[model samples]
Target: MNFLYPGFLFALLAIAIPIVIHLFNFRKFKKVYFSNVQFLKEAKEQNSSRDKLQHLLVLACRILAVMFLVFAFARPYIPLETGADPDKGNLISVYIDNSYSMETVNKEGNLLDEAKRKAKEIANAYQLNDQFQLLTNDFEGKHQRKLNKEAFIQMLEELKISPASRTMQQVVNRLQQEGDSRKNHLVYLLSDFQQNFVGTEKIKSDSSIRYSFISLKANALPNIAVDSVWSLSPVHQPKQAEQLVVQLHNYGAEDAADIPLKLTINQQQKAISNLNVPAGKSVKDTLSFGGLEKGWQKGVLSIKDFPITFDDELNFSFRVNSEMKVLTISGDPTQQFLKSLFAADPYFKLREMAEANINYSTFPEYSLIVLNGLKQPSSGLAQQLKSYVQNGGSLVIFPDLDAGAAVYTPFLTALSLPVVQELKTGKPVSSSIELKDPLFKDVFDQIPANMDLPIVNRYFSYLERNTAGKESILQLPLSQSLFARYPAGAGKIYLSASTLRPEDGNLSRHPVFVPLLFKVAFSSAKEQPMYYTAGKDDLLEQQKTSVSANQSLVLKSTDGTEIIPEIRQTPGKTLLYIADQLKKPGFYDLKRTDSVLAVLAFNDNRRESDMRYARDQNLKDLFAGQQISVHNSEKDALSLNIEAKNSSIELWKLCLILAVVFLAIEILLIRFFNKTKNIQKP
Candidate 1:
């Protein structure tokens, strides 16, 4: 038998009080009661023997009762495992989930606050000198080192809710990375155990590490959230109406009726709608707004929901460009067809330049770069175009009739594209349009199946190869690829077999020429989504006007915190690598020289908003082969049942029962002895 608190054994000395009392009684015996000596002596002797026997039995019962009571107070417990040692210190790690989901309020108050309290309790349950580690969703630098119990509790007290969300597997992996692995380690995970983020399937039982799950659950109350936001128009135009769609989900038992939603742009209320969301269902509502100024437009979609408010408002940041910039590079300056095609369009800002005078440094600024009538491509120009097309710029290539396949094959191979085999010139081949393509969608009122296709008198026949992401937008009469599109990193490349000159083909004057060219320019000008999820490794792309090589880009949040992210500079674009430094979600600005270059919005991980909890059985199933346990934080932390070699089974309850039994025997003996005295009265 062992005692959790061996110091309580001092209470066993209390038994001596009863023993001292039994040994020293001062009451005098009455001597003149029995006058008749002979008969009284015989009967008194019999009663005296019985009285002595009863007195000894009662004394023994009293001693046993006192001993049992002392043992109960001492809290004796048997060790479940003989090899378990109490002297060895343990390496304890406590993970307090401080995600936004922990903001839920129950009878015990806020779940995060309750988790912090339980974390302190777990720390107190261990010895003061034990090495401890505290982890949270922030995964800060201090979490990488172990601390004493005092420091661990101090760090635990400083924890606050964070926007970052990590799966259970991630938490375990982090513990394994930073925790002390030398000693016996016990990990306590205090969380609401949201099923979407917990990821039970990924948890495996480890013999070296024991886990205790402390789940904090709130009463099932109705929660509604603006689950997500999208738009009908992928490209935001200056004067065009943008139809925004917001999805509202009700994660409750009752239906939500007449939920008011509002849309605000640049801090001005733009549209409002009332939505009805069915129980355990999602409803999408559409709001239309137009006439946004040409610049960065900050938008917000908000809905009122009780208790859970982190996901109440969705922030949107998007750019509205006034015109599409098209840069046309021509080998033959006299080719007026290329210049005339885009000059009259108010939506296009066209700049034509000769091939020799083309500035490679300015390539990324244009939405589309047209390589018009180039007979032979230079290696230097090909290298510049490769980088341009990969960093979200669009390119259109027109092969010259005089240039051989050898001229363009090397450049095409560098971009993972098929090489042009030979030039074919014969009867004019008509073009077949792909109306279902996004570039052609809504372009024509109705597309005729047998419409007069563009005539191609000369075209390059491309070699056939099994390459992915090669799609034909326009096909020749024999199903040969005349114009095809290939995705290059975040951008695209369009390959045309024929030039736009009159002798090459009549395609320059075809009805499809204007819309086709306009689509290519608009496609490259599409803005990236304004918001990004933190810890998700999303790239932030910003347009660069003019920056020196030594200039640095810094991202600053609304709270005045600044971070230097990985910056990559292209011709007209700058890419920032948001690699895990930004944890909180809010409005952040990419700044250079104290000027706001671009504004970005970040959102908290939405997986926790679902409010689905993992059951105890799910954790058990996940840790099936390991010595693990699950516990509710509502219960006392000291009562945690761990199956280890030195698992303690408290015997205080048994001691209390034995103490009662002994006292009861003492009372029953007193009553029986008194009855015998009454019967023996002569």
Candidate 2:
């Protein structure tokens, strides 16, 4: 229908030259053999016609050869049916859904193995040089894997189901960018087809895309899991030992049968609690480990039998500093709030003595100094408090709200606090705080109405203007009281500006009262103890430090006896645990020779049960509604969250082979036809 080179058309006009020669009549022949002359003369006209026709056949062959040569140079390709955007090439992308739903058990098998089998089959079907990239939900830095058949299959074999979760929105976005299906993209998704991964409407794709689903397995396994667990050192006593509470949820719809759960601490079995958790509910289990030493502690909770596990066991660890010593030097006998709120908790020690009776040199051992309404401190007291704060001590003040302007100006100013102004505000409004202050960040969401929390009932004076750096909080409803404060370099300080008494409506009686104070005035200032067991996120920061790329370090205990740390640095300054062989709970002596550099503790959070596979379609939940596919089925196995893509060799290479084979056939046919004709002539 089309000609690439129209110039070849001129060859037809050249055929006319033969016609012109014939019409001119320029030929003559001599008579030889009189007997044939009669036949020759009669056939002459017919022979002339036949000769011209023979010449035309040869011309037609030459014209056709030239036309084919030009057509090959132009190069043509026919378009195929339209669909998702034409893939970068002829890529049929298969996104396997290895989510937890694949964990279901049937007579055939689990869905994950089925997905893997299908991937291998697909990989085998594709050419040996095609490209493929696999995608999964458990994404780390290296999430993409593009390989030919063998390597791609190997990677799929290495994939294991993960307890971690991901979303379908993420999977779809990644697949669109990473898949190599440029030509005929056959997007195959194999999955259990959980409710979370299916959609009512067809997803939008470019012209050449088609989707196929392989619905595999489903099982309604009843599972109860310890979904989450949190352990917080009380804001009030950061260094003290306390109980850990775990939250358990039965993901199933009905009441959970009584399950026996055990708690283990440092290899010490604590308690075995059996309780029936109501269906679709959560229950909190508390584990109390008594009198733990300062540093890291780890605990574990295990249930004997469970259908689904990914979340059945939990790991929790926390660090505790040394005991908190508070030196409360106060002349006022009304130390009722401090005496009752802290010392009575039995976790803290209050060395309460009159201000004049205290020894100044003993300040180094205390974690906090409570200056209760003491307007002036001796120069020695000032020096002691100053040094204590420099070493990270907590300080709390009960300033005299009624004191005169110059009453404690010099002492306060030394801590970067402003001088007070007398008669600045006559009547301060009784109101709630405008905003929950950071010192009170924990209680910000816990505001309760109708709880008659006292306003800072009264203020005799106000801090001088422009003295606000970090020293003010809780603005007055009518601008009077400096309700709370934290002066720099003086450690953490909270000033009530009013007395804690019932006549002031006793706001301290509320549940938010003590915790807020503890978090603000002391929580953030907790100091690291001399020993620490390594945690999930642990690091050491030092200046100008080095060891032969690999070397050991040591640490000593209080008496300079225990030397711990039998570690040799590998490559970086960081060390990671590659195996589960954990050290027993005890003080460790680290050493390189007799020189002691640090003391350490060894403790591990036990892994109660080895069951890791999730029994649900968490992968579908993770990806939201991405299509997933699976092939071979296993009766039972953990859910696989990472789906592998089908891989095959390059299509262009196959196309080249076809062209080569066709050329060989064309040459063989020409040779055979000529040879056969010669044989027939014989």
Candidate 3:
């Protein structure tokens, strides 16, 4: 027993007041006449015994009232928990695991809902004298500090689960830093063991702290998932073939049954096939197209199952990349070199058309038309070339050894090129090339001039092409081997004084070979964009974990004391999600409606053995060694149960009770004493 106000023991000296008042309780004896003495003596002898009885009764009543008052002042109470904190104790760090998987339902239908109810009851049961610290998955700024009940609850409400993941080892690190080896501390973890959570075993630091792991998701339903799809082979080309190979997976407790699969492209059925895969294993199958046009396209793959979330369905798209059909308007074999390159590429379809002889509309379907060793382009061909360049087509020109300036003038002029300058007796030579340009990215950087092949010492003239209003990409060092060019409206032009024959030794291919034709040609090509399907497993190829969960399942229990799941993995010490651990007591769950086979973590639970629920031993041990026994004389120990304890209340109800008792005692004593007086009188 303990008194809340031990200082009230001083109220016991109050006994002295009643004792002194009773002993000297008197008015001055009034001096009276001598005749009064004789009558006074007779009355005194008769009522003397009665007066002594009244005096003794008054002394007993006064002492009893004083003792009761002292007891009331020293209020006493007994501790519910022996050795427990009536005032102070060690701090408890509660880490709540709030992750997505906690959303999973148990047989009760609500995992987090049940967890919160249990947690609050636990908290309320603990005495208010205990101090606590709250924690969550995000161990930053908030939840990382110590607080009282009101403050701790405020931080708890602010907690939310992130898309990121967490592990026990990461959380143990923070606790190890804050925990003192000399003092007692406990960490309570509450979370659902989603397929990705880290269990308690990986917490391997050699600290003397206690930990408890309350797993949130127990007895969850088995789930299935979509794994991946491989790229379609070009060899499977058919107007009716939309070939995309794919794989599916099941993560059930037991093997799953094979089910039929349907495919949809741009909202229409392209192909359907049944993929036979074993539980925890994946299977591959080819899906073909019904009939579809050429271009980039999108599609969906789906499956049916309860929870509707972890089923086999994903989003994907692929491009047909229509092949380019090109027409070479000349029957020149210099055509063979260029023809072979384009012919080998699947995207380019090359063919030789008749020379452009004034009629040009017959080639509208051709993406580009080339000229080699033919008459220079006429007005109609020049106009057609302008349209093709504007419409994003490419062209290559190789001049004849004796091709005159007048024949090629209209073509160059229509391309917005300067007038051509004739070469003098000496042949010019090319010194170097530009490697930074994209056209030279692959092989153009240092292609040696093909000067050894043909040496035309006296065959053609060189062009002194005008330099006004032009953007030159390459310059031939000497008067002999330079290729200078620029872009016009939607087309580009090149002026040269030599022919395509290796003998010219000054062609763009020889030294100008790099920047002259190839550089300009590479720039004119169009670009294509690529897309990878969502929910594909390859996105997780290098990832350490692969996980799936019910859309309705959350990862942390409410009141945050349950165990979060451990992900599958090869073992080691690692920190997941932001390297922070939540061991607080609260509810934690997940968001986002998409189901994905994501890689998660695996952890150890060696840390869970640390919790000991220590109590405050200071006061208990202090009293155990002392042999003191304090008490109230009216009874043994102090108790407010006495009716006198309520006597101090100024309320009329208490006053009425006292008034009735006081009058009854007084009247009965007076009546009995008067009867004694009558007997003495007779």
Candidate 4:
């Protein structure tokens, strides 16, 4: 047993007062004449012996009462085998889960409110001088420092529901960083313990710190969430048909049927549908909409869900271009096939440049660059095109058959494409087409058995080596590739074996030429991510834009919240660091001074959408090697439990009770002894 305030033990000296009073008779004896009778002598002897016994008994009781009283004031307690010493000041770190999932209700009310109450109770269990650190999912800078009891309680009152969420390990790591090393450290985590909280692996904890998990329980609730969404069309055009795919997930045990889903674009209703999602599974549905103007389109997909509604709606954004730009760099001035094909439609703005007069600086402005028989391709042009394709641009290469292998080998090698080995003069018809590939998907309504495939008269056979990202769109006899698509970093490269000359086969004028080239051109438009998660996606990436050294980019939200993110320029893109700035979900415009550069969408993380919680045993198993305790939320009065766990068994209250009992014994002894003497006299 240890004493909280050992200095109070000095009060034990007061016990000497009772001993002195008993040893020396302080009261003056009154001389009486009634003591002369011989018969009273025998009674005097018996009374003298009984009187001495009663005096000794009364002194012992008085001494014990004083001693017990002093012990009570000293606050004695037995130290538990684990945890910090109760005598010293403690640094307690309490983590309250204020995530979106904490909005769930139980018998005690909302989980977040219950967590706050329990946190206060924990603080009350300790001394007022003990320091406290409050941590939430936001991980604000103010929470990093320690606060006194009053300040900690004030901060707790100000906390509300936040969109941010964290795992168990992250909370532990933050707690470990706080507090003083000399002081005893104790941690309390109050949360509903969602399944995602445990993360993928076991938790790593410090052996010196004692951890207690107060698991708050909630009623079982069925939940359905809008998991994700994506556009089927890679490129968006004005007044064009577009299909969007939305995924729905049912986290409940029973299947959900006829869940109403709605899609809105620019504050106008676009499409509506109903879906059936199975238990613990996901289902996808497609919505078709059109007539979008040439501008930024803010799209919102929503579903009707109860109890947990944060993840019911998803926000997304995309851009619809008014015209597609196509650049053609031709070695032969009279190569009019591509120029005439694209010029027929006003939607395609075709720009033709000769080999010697090509402007290299304007490569990023076009959606697709068509190389029409570039005779003697230079190393500089190849390097520029390589970087363009790798940075999400699309390119088509029609190699000049008359050019030597030495001139073309270096250009093809730089782009990681197969080099031409030898020219074949025999006419070979195309064998098969990859009809199921995404490039050709939905292009053909029906396949004909006697379809006319592209024929090649004189073509170069490539000496292929690496076939990792190569997809053969058109194949010749003997498994030779006539045309294929190669995935280069973020973009794609389409290579054809023959040029657009009359001497070559009719591939340039074939029926498949129109759809094939148009599909590639349409796919060249860089498709940014439709949406980003609020907390998870802190970095926003965009195509590199020229910004003056004095000017800065600002992300302005719909509600007039603006923030200047840190910019980081890379080879072909710019990265903006938006750490913890975005909390709400909606559309935000990236602006340069007065002009809007792009529209970015953000949505809340859906990890908190699932209402499933981890069991006590599961948490114990996660922290198997650590000294952790799990508290049940059903039990009220957490202060007593915390006091017992943190400081071990306290004996001060028991000492006080014993002190009262001894005083009562002293009173009874004096009363009984005096009654007996009076009875003997009668």
Candidate 5:
């Protein structure tokens, strides 16, 4: 038991006043001659006894009333927990969830707003000099330092919803890192308790810090979101038919029908489609649009959804080049088959160069580089090809008939590919194509078993084992690799074991050669991702090009937010990190001064779109062995069952009620006992 103001207990001494007054009642005695002695004797006995009893009873009541009144003013209470001293102040840390999920509104209005209101009340509950800290989802610089009461309140007022998200465990970890372990620490968490964000397993029960969870739950409602978007073709072609596939998800219980989806390119409406999504499921629909203009174009795929508008619109950026530049370096310029293949297609701009005259500096300008019948692979050319592949350029290698193992081994080793071991010269071996591969997808409805396959007579075998990124696209008889594809860095390598000469079995003149070469050229162009998530570590790779003396790259968002990100020059690519600059989801432009270099789409994290929330029981289970209590946001903070000294059970109100009851009894006894008074007889 304790008193908030124990000095007021001296008022209990005032009970002596009632006790003294009851003991020393002074009255003038009037002597009267009574003739009837028998009647007088009986009346005196009865009246004297009743009068004495009433006096004692009233005295007890008056004394108790005074005592109870003094005790009430003292404001005594029982400490909720006896281990801690009530006089000691607390080190308080309050975490308010300010993620996109906090935008939900209920009767108390926005959850974030309500959380701030409750947080302020919590701060007011503590003493002014008590240490305080404020934390949010952003984990900003301000959150690291402790603030005074006034400063903490100001921070709470300035808090807003952010695209970033942190789990419950993260908040606890942050608090632990910044909290004062020596003092009695208290953490008050106010949030909607989204289930995905509740990573309580990462939290350990700490005896030093007490936790209080204030759950702010809104009405459960359904939500629809544009999960993602992808194009039918990986590479974008100018003035060609393209399909944009939009993926939709329903996080509700009911089915959605006839949901209108619109696609816009370069601020112009391109295509629209209607989709039906089932409850707790996902669906994908394709939007066909043609006449794609050359150069960079910003595209947006949008749909109508209630409440959650963040994921309603999906933005993406793509480019359609005027023509695909093919740089073919040949040991023999008389190889007409190599020239005719690329020259026949108008979409392909073929530039043939002798192996000796090839300039490595101009390699980044081409989408695909062909190394045709190179008699010997020079160390300089091998190093240049390695840098080119790393910077997102495709390479197709056809070994010369007399090519040496030593000439190409160093080049293969640099790119983490298999080296040439030995050259085989024998009867023609038929080719077996991988029909279900993405390269051959939709190329043929069904492959004919008896179809004429390409045959290789003279070929090179591998010296090293195949890597995880290496896949055999075409296999020869006796399980030998005819054509293998190896992914090196951001680019790919298509290596054929056989030469392209007539003596090498006419693989270059086969019908399968045309589409195989075309697919390699088409797929070489780097396809930009449909969208990137905000608050994630993402780097946008741009092709390295010759810039003017004063030109520099800059990033600008659709909302007029811009920043010059740190540019990292790697070999043949420019890497720009936009994770820090992507505060919100929208279209952002990578430009050189005023000229837009590339368009990049960013979307908010869809993890918050799910409406599921952690229940009170779930939280309790999460902190089972810890000193924690959970309550609804709308309830009073002080009303919850907590271990803090501020939660003292006040006995003042109970004492005040006892005081009133005792005074009433004292008055009734005085009034009733007076009726029996016999002053004349005495």
Candidate 6:
């Protein structure tokens, strides 16, 4: 036990005043004439003994009353913890969870409102001069500094539900960064403590910092969320058919039936359907739509979910190009197979160039580049093409089979393709095609037992040292790769063994040539993601763009709000770092001055959709070795518990109550005892 104000103990000397009064007899006795002196003497003896006992009891009560009153002024309490003297000032950090899940309601009302109230109570429990820090999911820069009691309460009132969500370890790391080492640290986290919030990993904490977890409860709600949406086609063309896969999740115990799903593009209804989702499981459905114009298309996939609607709607954006550019650099300009194939469709803009007159600077302008029969490929061209392919540009290589091994060795090895080992002059027929590959998964409607595969009169066999990422699209009789695809960094390489010359092979004239090249060209569009999570994705990648010293890119929303993101230039791409700049779930246009460069969509993180909270034991297990305590908001007195853990268990009120009871006892002994003695004498 210790006293908060030990100097008040000097007032305990007042107890001696009662002792002095008892010792000094200041009352005078009145004598009366009485008959029967002997009987009066016996009565006087018994009454004297009773009078002494009453006087002694009165003195004892007076002493105890004075002592307890002094103790109450001193303010004694039992210390709970040994570290950190209560005499010194304290630094308190309180984290209030204002995420979307906190919008849940309980018997006491909204959880966010209750959390704010609890935060204010915690602030009031501390001393006036003590410094306090208020933290929330937003993690704003202004919340890093400490504030006084008045300012803390004012800030608490200004908090609102935010789209940002953070895990328990992340919150603790932030608090640890803002703690003052000089003062004792007390950290309080008030949240619903969802299982997702307390991630699977164990929490690392400082032993010196005391942590308190106050778990809030709410009424259970059943929810079905549109988990995700993705496009089946990599490239989008104007007035072409498209398909999108939408995944829905049921987070309740009971299954949901006939949930209406809707798709809208550019504010017009494109497709609609009904779905049935099983309990605690996910279901995927495909929506087919077409007739989109040539520009940026803003798409919204929505479902009608009640009570919890934040994760019901998903926003996405994509571009439908009017034409696809194809660049071809061939050693023989007379080859007209590729030219005739693209000329049949105006959607493909083909530009032909000789190997000696190729412009390396305009490589990024084309989606696909074809190197047709480059007899003696230069090392500089190989290096440039390698960089272009690694930065998400697609390439097709039709090697000049007559060229020596030394000429094509460096080029093939630079692009991580198999090198040409030997040239064979035998007629080998292509045995089979990989119908199950993603390239030809939907291209064939039916397959015959004996398919008329391509025939090769003369070809070059490759020396494949590593087959990690090699996928044989067209195979020869002896399991040899005639046409294969290899994944290099972020792009793909399609390698063919024969050239377009009639003496080489008839693959250029085969029926499978058109669709194979079309699929490869379509897959080269560098499809940016349909959407990005707001707080999770910080970097946005785009094809390289030219920006002058005076020009900058701006991201503008529909409300006219704009932000200039940090721009970083790499070899074949431009990276825009919009760290935490996007908070709302909608479409934002990335523009250079007045012209829109691209449209980007952002959505809230769906981890909060689970709506399942972590148990107290789970939280304890996460921070097993740390000095942590868990309290339920519905059961514990948060302020008193915090106070008791921070400082001590107070005894001043108990001391005051005992003082009043002693004073009442002293009054009874003085008045009632004297009346009884007088009655016995009569």
Best by TM-score: 4
Q: What would the TM-score be for candidate 4 when compared with the true structure?
A: 0.90
Residue 662 in candidate 6, Cα distance off native in Å: 3.9
lDDT of 4 at 266: 97
lDDT of 1: 0.79
Which is superior by lDDT, 1 or 5? Answer: 5
- TM-score, one value per model: 0.79, 0.52, 0.37, 0.90, 0.82, 0.88
Give one clash count per candidate, in the order shown.
0, 54, 64, 0, 0, 0
Task: Choose 4 or 5, whichever is better by lDDT.
Answer: 4
Runs in model 3 deviating more than 4 A are 1-93, 98-100, 125-163, 170-185, 194-196, 199-201, 204-209, 234-242, 258-260, 264-269, 275-277, 290-299, 308-312, 316-338, 344-682
Q: Ten consecutive residues with minimal summed lDDT in candidate 2?
A: 673-682
- For model 2 the local lDDT of residue 568 reads 33
Model 4 is weakest, by summed lDDT over 10 consecutive residues, at: 673-682
Question: In candidate 5, which residue pairs get closer than 3 Å at backbone N, Cα or C atoms, i.e. clash?
Answer: none
lDDT of 6 by residue, 1-682 (tens): 8888899999999999999999998999898777778777877998898989999999999999999999999989777663665666688899998888998889989999999888877777777889999999998998998999999999998999888888888899999999998888888899998889998899998877888888889889888998999888767888889999999999877899999999999999999999999999999999999999999999999999888899999999999999999999999888898899888878889999899898999987888999999988998998889988887788999988878678898889887788888887875555468888887867889998888877787777899999998999998767688889998766788998777777777788888888889888888886678898887788999877789999999999998878789999876678999887777778899999889999999898898888899999998899988777888887544445644356567799999999999999999998898565432344
Judge candidate 3 against the unseen true structure and give its global Cα lDDT, from 0 to 1: 0.48
* Per-residue accuracy of model 2 over 1-682 as CA lDDT, tens digit each: 2232345555545545545654565768776564565565666665566556544443444344444443443332222233222223445555666554556565556657767776777667556766656665454434465566778788779766543333344455556666554444555556665444443334444433444445565555666776555554443234345666777766666787778888775567866788688876788877665656555555567675456664565544445555566767775667577677776555466788676687877775666777775645556666666656654566766655445446656666565555555534343345455354655554556666764444545454546556555544545555555456655453555555555554543455655567655555355345333223222113432111244545555544435443223333322122322121222233444445655333344322112111133223444343334443333333222232212232121233333444455445545543452232111111
Q: Write the residue-wise lDDT of candidate 3 on 53-103 in tens digits.
A: 886666666665565556556654453322322223445566666544444
Q: Clashes in candidate 6: how many? A: 0
Query: How many clashing pairs in candidate 4?
Result: 0
* Per-residue C-alpha lDDT of model 4 across residues 351-375, encoded as one tens digit per residue: 9999989899999998899998888
Report the poorest 10 consecutive residues by lDDT, candidate 1: 80-89
Better of 2 and 3 by TM-score: 2
lDDT of 4 at 294: 97
Could you tell me which residue pairs clash in candidate 6? none
